[model samples]
Target: MKIGELANRSGLTPSRIRFYERIGLLKAVDRKANGYRSYPAEAVTILGLIALAQGAGFSLDEIRALLPADLEHWEHDALAGALTRKVADIETLQARLARSKAHLLHVIDEIEARPDDIDCATNARRVLTRLLGEDAEMPVASLRAKQF
Candidate 1:
């Protein structure tokens, strides 16, 4: 099938399909004598795999590693490795989210318990700045140094 047919069948743009080929995700397609790219019937299945990988949050580089030379005989190891890495990333993100939530709770508490006074306002502003990482920035338990 021509690239146009593949695009219609796979719902992928010609540029994207070509890019996948260039990036070693898709097989290099055969070209007609006129230099038009011709894909085999199996291209649809390969493209489908690429789409599935994207939906699973695998980067192109990761997907390229995960795709097997023979789809029908894919190894479990590749899939396991990819999933393990994704799990690690998710764990890191979860940790960050916990920290952010903790900071938000602290800010709410401060706002609720703060005394309305000139000295208190200055101290509160200083604390916020510290959490956000001011002058010489470094990660601190407080979110004051963070820029929202």
Candidate 2:
């Protein structure tokens, strides 16, 4: 198939496919005598895998690492370990997301409880400081105003 055909089949843009090739996430296809890019049927599966990896929040660099090495040279155990670690990382992300959502809800409740004239700038600073310690970046107004 041509690049366009592969792209259509993979549901990825030709430019994105080209970019993946350029980045080493996807290998370049052979060119025809006319100098047009000629993709093999397997390129579709490779592109689909790339899309799946990206959807999982794996960076292109990470995806490159995930690519299977020549089995003749690389051990299957290494790939298994990489996948295991990826699963663990995803679990950590889910836990962190849940915590962040809970914290945001708490902030909303605090904001709602504050009096109108008083700025919550101080409260914001306290939250930031508690989360990031004294080294947290804070605006000057956060020190003076109780509300913002």
Candidate 3:
């Protein structure tokens, strides 16, 4: 089929299809005598898989590495290993994000706990003390020197 039909069938833009072809991800394409791109019916399926993989956090390079030259044959063990590694990577990221979210929530709570009579600097010191221990009481110049 033509590029337009392939784009419609694959739910991808013409430019994206062209980009995939250019990047060596979509290999089952041919050039017609009239200079139009001709794609096999399987191109639709290939494009779908590429999109799915991307949604699952696979980079284009990773997808290219995972894609078999011939759709009929796959290196099952390699595929399984790569998928397992990706899952682990995602889990690590989730844990880090959860910690970051919790830290932000804690900071928000501290900032909101300011007393009516205390000045802004006092409240800032109180929050910093709660977060950074006695080090929050150190002089600004001392902190700057310590940073280096």
Find the candidate with the highest lDDT and give its number. Answer: 3
Better of 1 and 2 by TM-score: 2
Give candidate 2 regions above 4 Å deviation.
69-75, 115-148
Specify the poorest-scoring 10-residue window by lDDT in model 2: 67-76
Give each model a TM-score.
0.69, 0.70, 0.86
Give candidate 1's whole-model lDDT. Answer: 0.81
lDDT of each: 0.81, 0.74, 0.91
Candidate order (lDDT)? 3, 1, 2
lDDT of 2 by residue, 30-78 (tens): 8788988987777887888778877877788877887753223444686
Decoy 1 TM-score against native: 0.69
lDDT of 3 at 42: 90
Off by over 4 Å in 3: 119-122, 134-148
lDDT of 3: 0.91
lDDT of 2 at 112: 67
Between prediction 1 and prediction 2, the one with superior lDDT is: 1
Tens-digit per-residue lDDT, 35-82, candidate 1: 999998889999998998789678998888888876676779878987
Name the lDDT value of residue 35 in candidate 2.
87
Residues 54-79 of candidate 3 have per-residue lDDT tens digits of: 99999999999999997999999999
